[model samples]
Target chain A: MIECNNLTFSYRKATPILKEFNLTLENGGIYGLLGKNGAGKSTLLYLMCGLLTPAAGEVLVNGVNVRRRLPSTLRDIFLVPEEFDLPSITLEDYCRINAPFYPDFSMEALKRNLETFEMPEKIHLGYLSMGQKKKAYMCFALACNTPILIMDEPTNGLDITSKVQFRRFLAAQMNENRIILISTHQVHDVELLLDHIVIVDNRQLLLNRKTSEITSRLRFFNTLGAPDTDDPRLLYSARGVGGFANIARREDPLDEETDLNLESLYELCCRNPKLVENIFNPDNTSEHEQLG
Target chain B: MNNLDNFDKFSFSRFMMLAKREIISSKNIFLMELAVVAGLIIIAEFFISWSALPSLNDVKEYPSCYYSDSTCVSIIFVLGIWGFAFLANIAASLVCLKLSNKKGRITTFMTVGTQGEKYLLNFLIYDVFFVLYFFTVWLLVDLVRVIYVDMVYPFEGKWVLFYAIDQWNWMVALGTIALFLFSQAFYTLVSAFSPKLAFLKAFGLSYAVGFLLIPYSFFCSVVLIDKSFSGESNVIVIMASSVMIIYAIAMQLLAYYRYKETDII
Candidate 1:
C-alpha cells in the first residue's frame, strides 16, 4: 500500500502543485491517474515513488516512509518516468547489470514481455528507436515484479500497434499483489485496463473512484440531441464527429445501464466538478441534487 | 512479503553491485581514457626519441650521456606521473558528470541503492578506482616503452621507472595522494550539487582559486610573515596541505548530504 498523507509540494518560484494532497493506493489494481496538463498528476506519482520529497507531510509505502528510500523499499518499487536514459549497452547486459538489484526480477517475464512487444531480445537499448526503447524498458520494469509500479506517460512514445500490445502486456502482468499507477493524458489507451480512476485538478483530488463505482454512479451515452431527463440531470454534453451528442448523466436506479466512457467521464468531471463530486459523495448531496 | 525494515542500508554486497554496474555502464569511458593515455605516451615517446637522435650530422648534443642522466630521467618520469595524475582528474570529473548530469541516469542510480551506498560508490569510482587505474596504465605504458627502446635503440642507462622509484619519498607520495583526494572530492561535490555543466563549474572554480592563490601567497609571504621566507614557505605548504585534506572531508560530507536530499524531478 502507498499512502500520501497531507502531502504538499511546489517547485521553486512556482505556485504550489500539490497542497495538502492526501491519497492511498492499495495492492491489486491498475489505477489510471487523470488530470490537466499542469494538474500535478506527475508530481503526485513522483512523490509516491519517493523521487520527489514532499514539502510537507509524508509519503509512506507499505508503512515505511518513502523519503528514507530504504533499499528494500526501493527494491520493491519501480518508477518508469516519462523520459529516461538507457546506457549504450545491449539489453542483455543492461538486464545483467540491473536485474540483480531487485531480488524478484524475472528473466522469464522479461522474455515474455519482449515477445509480446515484438522487440528483439538481443538489441542494444541505445540503438533502438524511442518507441522501441520505451517498450524494452517497460518490459524490464515489469520483469522486476516489484510490488508497486508507477509509470508516467508510458504510452506517449508508443506506436498504435505497440500501444495495443502495451495494454495487453500490462493486463497480463497485473496480479493481486501488484499495484500499478499510471499518470497520463492519454486516457483512451488505458481505459479498459484501469481498475480505478483518480482525477486531480488544481492540487485537489476531485475523484478517486473505482471503475465499477464510477459506472454505477454515472451513465455515458450518445444521442441525436440532448435527452430530456429530470431524475438524471445532464452533467456534461458535447458534440461528436457525427450528428451525435456525447452525454454523461448521474446514474439512477430506474434508468437503463450504460457503459462508462472514460474520456466522456473525464470531460464531465472536468466540466462539472462540483456536480460530479456531489454525485459521488452521498453526504454532499444537498446542493447538487437539485441538478439531478 | 518483502520486509523493508530488515533491509541493510549500507550493505557491502550492494556497494559491490553498484560498483560493478558503474564499471559496465562506463566501459566506453574507460576505453576512451586508455586510448587517450596511450596516445599521449606514444606521442611523448616519439618526441623524446626524435629529440635524442643526432640531427643528420653525426653530432649528438650529449652523446650517450643524455639517456644516462638521472636528473633527465627524473624530470621525464615526474612529468609522466603528473600527466597521468592530470588525466586521472579529468577522468574522475567526467565520471561524476556523467553519473549526475542526466535525470534518467541519476534516477536509475538512486533507485538501485540507498543514498549512502550511492555516495560511497561515487567515492570508490572517482577517488579510488581512477587513481589505481592511472597507476596500472602508467605501468603498462612504461613496460611498452622499455621494450620498444630496448629493441629499437638499446641504451646503457638507468630505466625511468627505477629512477622515479629511487627519487620517490614517502612524505611527498603521501602529500600527492592527499592532494589527489582533495581534488577528486571537490569535483565530486561540484558534480553532486550541479550535475549539468559539472566539469565547467569545477574547472571555473579551480581557475578562480588558482588565480586568487598567487596574490594570497604573496600577501602572506611579504606582509603576514616578517620572519625568514623559507620558514614561512614551509609553514604555508604544511598548513595548505592540512587545510586541503580537511576541506576535502568537508566536501565529501556535503556531497553525501546532497545525494541524500536530491530529488530528481
Candidate 2:
C-alpha cells in the first residue's frame, strides 16, 4: 500500500509540479494514472520510489517513509522509467551484476521473461533495439518482484505484438501482493486491465475512484436530439458526431447504458475538473450515492 | 522474494551494477586506449634512456633528447606524466557525463540512488583503475630499458627504476588526484545546468581552467627558479593537488544538495 499526504514539489521556487497532492492506494490492483503532458504523473512516481524526496509531504509505503530509503523500504518499489540507460554489457552480465542488489531477484523468472520475448542471451544490451531494450528492462523490473511497481509510459514505443505480449506478461505476473501503477497517455491500451483510475491535473488530484464505481454510478452515452442541458448532475459533456453529450447520472427515463470509453472519460474529467472533483470528494458521500 | 523490501536499499547495488555494466561494455575501447598509452611509454623510455646514457657514441640530440645537454630525461618524463593526466581526466569526465545523462536530461536524478554519491564513486573507481594501469605499464617499460642499458654499459650512480620512481611517481600520484578532483567539479557544474550542455560545458570549463593554470605554473616556476627549489616546488604541487581534491569533494556535496532540493524529474 502507498499513502501520500499533502505532497508538494517544485523544480524552482515558484514553479511547483505537485501541490498538496494526497492519494491512497491499496494492494492487488492495476491503477491507471491519467494526465496530459506535464501533469506530474512521473513526478509522483519518482516520489514513491524515493528517487525524488517530497519538499513538504510524506510518502509512506507499507508504513515506512520512502525518503528514508532504507534497504527494507526500497525492496518493495520498482520504477521502470520512460527513459533509462541500459548498461553497455551483455544481458547476462547485466543480470549477474544486478542480481545481488535484489535479494529476491530471480534468474529463473528473468530468463523466462526473456524467453517469452525471444531475446538473445549473450548479446550486449547496448546493441539491442529500443523495443528489445525495454523488454529487457521490464523483465528485470518484474523479476525484482517488488510489491510496488511503477511504469511511466511503458507502452509508448512498443509494436502491436509486443503490446499484447506485455499485457499478457503483466496479467500473468500480477498478484494480490502487488500494486501496479502505470502512467500513460495510451489509456485505451490499459483500460480493460485497470481496476482503479487516478487522474492528476492542474497541480491537484482531480479524481481517485474504483473503475467499477465509475462504470456503475455514471453512464456514458451519445445523443442525437435535444441534449440534457439543465441537469445539475451532468458531470462533463463533449460534442459527438450528432451533438454534445457526456457521462451523466443514470436516470431511468432518459439515460441509457453505452460503452465507457476511458479516453472519453479522461477528456471529460480534464474538461470539467470541478464537477469531477465534487463527485470524487469523500465528503460528498451522499452525492456519490446519488449517482448510484 | 518478499514483496515488502525497501526499494532504496537496492540503489547502491544497482548503482554498482550500472557502473560495472558500463565498464565492461566499453572495455574494448578502453583497452585500445590503454594499449596505446602503454606502447608510448615503452617507446619514450627507450629514447630517453639512449640519450641519458653517458656513452658519447650513443648520444642523440634529435627526437630522443632534443635537450640532451640539459635535463632532457626529466622534461620528457614530466611531459609524459602530463599526457597521462589528460587522458585519465578525459576518461573520467566522459563516464560521469554519460551516467548523468543516462535517463534523458530531466530524468537523470530519477536513477535509483543519490546522484552525487553515484557520480563520485564512479569517477573515483575509474580514475584509480586507469592510474594503476598507467603506472604499472610505465614501470615495466622503464625497468626493461634500465636492464638493457645496464647490460650494454652500466650507469655509475643511478638505479634506473629508483630514479624513475623518485622523479615520476609524485607527479603521477598528484596528476591522478588532480584528474579525479577536476573531473568531479567540472562534471558536477555541467550536469547541474543541463544534460544537453553538460559534456560540452565541462570540456570548455576544464580547458579554460587548464589554460589559466599554465600562467600560474609559469609564475611558480619563475619564483622557484633557483637550483635548490626542487623539494619546495614538489611539496607545493602536492599541497595544491590536495586542495583540488578537497574542492572536488565540496563540489560533489554541493551537487548532491542541489539534487536533493531540485525537482527536475
Candidate 3:
C-alpha cells in the first residue's frame, strides 16, 4: 500500500504544484492516472517514489517512510519515467549489472517480455530507437517483479502494433498482489487495462472511482444531433463526430447496459467537474438536477 | 515472509553490487584515460632524456659523477609521476562523481541502493580506485624509464626504485598524506556542488586556495614560528598538517551532506 498524507510540494519558492493533496493506493489492480499537461501527474508519481522531497506531510509505502529511502523500501518499488537514457551497454550486460539489486528479479519474465515486445535478445540499449528502448526498459521493469510499479507515459513512443502488444504484455503481467500506477494522457491505449481511474486537475483530485462503479452509476450512449432528453437523468453531453452527441446519463432501472467511453468521460469531467462530483456522491444532491 | 522488515543498516553485498555497476558503466572511459596517460608519459620521458643528456655534455666543468649519480633522474621521475597521478585523480573524480547528475541515471541510482551505499561507491571509484590505478601506472612507467636509461647510458651507480622512499622523512610523509587528503576532499566538494562543470570549478578553486594558503603559511612560518620555535622547521609542518586535516574533514562532511540532500531537478 502507498499512501500520500496531505502531501505538499513545489519547486523552490514558487506556488505549490500539489497542495494538501491526499491519496491512498492499495495493492492489486492497474490504476490509470489522468490529468492535463501541467496538472502534477508526474509530480505525484515522483513524490510517491520518493524522488522528490515533499514540502509538507509524508508518503508511506507499506508502513515505511519513502523519504528515508531505506533499502527495504527501495527494493520493492520501481519507476519508469517518460524520458530516460540507458547506458551504452548491451542489454544482457545491463541486466547483469542491475538485476541483482532486486531480489525477486526474474530472467524468465524478462525473456518473455522481450519476446512479446519483439526486441532482440542481445543489443546495446543506446543503439536501439526510442520506441524500442522504451519497450526494453518496460520489459526490464516488469521483470523486476516489484510489488509497486509506477510508469509515466509508458506508451508515448510506441508504434501502433507495439502499443497493442504493450497492452497485452501489461495485462498478462498484472497480478492480484501487485500495484501498477500508470500516468499518461493517452487514455485509449490503457482504457481496457485500467481497473480504477483517477483524474486530477489544478492540484485536486476531480474523480476517483473504480471502473465498474463508474460504469454502473452512469450510462453512456450516442444520439443524433444534440441530446434533447427531457428526462432529468442527463449529467453531461458533448458533440461527437457525424453530428452525434456523446452523452452520459444517470443509470436508471430501464436503461440498457452501455460501456463507459473513457475519452468522452474524461472530456466531460474536465468541463463539468461539479456535475461529476454530484453524480458520484449522492449526498450532495442540492444542485444535482443541473445538466450540461 | 516479511522481507520488507529485514532491512540491514549496512549491506556489504549491496555496496559491492553498486560498485560493480559503476565500474562496468565506466570501464570504457577508464581504458581510454589509461591509454592517454601512457602516451603522455612516453612523450614526457622522451623530452626529459633529450634535453638533459645534451646539457650534461655542454657543461664540461662539472664532474662526471654528478651527471651519473641517478639521484636527479629518480627525483624527476618521481615528481613526474606525482604530477600525472594528481591530474588523473582530479579527472577521475570529476567524471565519476557526476554519474548521478543526469535525470535518468539519478532515478536509477536512487532506486538500486541506499544513499549511503551510493556515496561510498563514489568514494571507492573516485578516491581509492583511482589512487591505486595511478600508482600502478606510475610504477610501470618508472620501471620502463629505468630500464631504457640503463641500457643506453650504463651509469656507474645503481638506480634504485623509489629512491626517496628509502630515506623518507616522517614530516614529509605526514605532509604528503595530508596534502593527498586535502586534494581529494576539495575535488569531492567541488564535484558534489558543481556537477555540470566540476572539473573547471575544482581546478579554479584548488589554485585559489593554494595561493591564499601558501603565502599565509610561508609568512607565518618565517615571521612567527621561526622566532617562537627557535628555528625548528617541523613547527611549520605541524601547523600545515593540522590545517589540511581540518580542511579535509570539513570539506568531506560538506560534500556528503550536499550529496544526501541533492534533488534530481
Best by DockQ: 3
Candidate 1 at residue B168, lDDT? 61
Span of 10 residues, lowest total lDDT, candidate 3 chain A:
A283-292
- Which runs of model 1 end up more than 4 angstroms from their true locations? A229-232, A243-256, A284-292, B1-6, B52-61, B98-102, B147-155, B211-239
Q: What lDDT score belongs to each candidate, Candidate 1 first? A: 0.74, 0.67, 0.74
TM-score of each: 0.88, 0.76, 0.89
Residue-level lDDT of model 1, residues B1-265, one tens digit each, is 2454446457787788889988898789767866777678767755765565444344444346454455555545655655665665564455445446446544654466777777677667755776676566666665665665555446644566676667665445544565666776777788777776776788689778873235333433332223233555666656766887898899878876876777765
Candidate 3 segments whose C-alpha is farther than 4 A from its true place: A243-245, A284-292, B1-8, B54-71, B77-85, B88-105, B155-160, B209-231
In the range B1-265, model 2's lDDT, one tens digit per residue, is 2343434433565566656744675677777888888877778776776556646555443224233333444544454556565565455445435434436433344334444445555555556777788877876776676566555544522333465555444544564456456565656656655545565677687668784246334522332222233566778767767877787778767665654555434
lDDT, model 2: 0.67
Instruction: Evaluate model 1 with DockQ and give the value.
Output: 0.55
Indicate the worst ten consecutive residues by lDDT in candidate 2 chain B. Answer: B219-228
Output the number of the TM-score-best candidate.
Answer: 3
Per-residue lDDT tens digits of candidate 3, residues A1-292? Answer: 9998878888897778887777888889799999999888988888888878898989999988887778888888898989887777898998999898888999999999999988778879878999999999999999999999999999999999999999999999999889999999998899989988988875668787888888888887878667766767776667767755465665575777677788888887888787788778868645322110
Worst 10 residues of 2 chain A by lDDT: A283-292
| Segments in model 2 whose C-alpha atoms lie over 4 Å from true places | A11-15, A52-55, A63-74, A118-124, A220-260, A277-292, B1-19, B25-29, B32-36, B39-70, B99-117, B147-160, B166-227, B230-252, B255-265
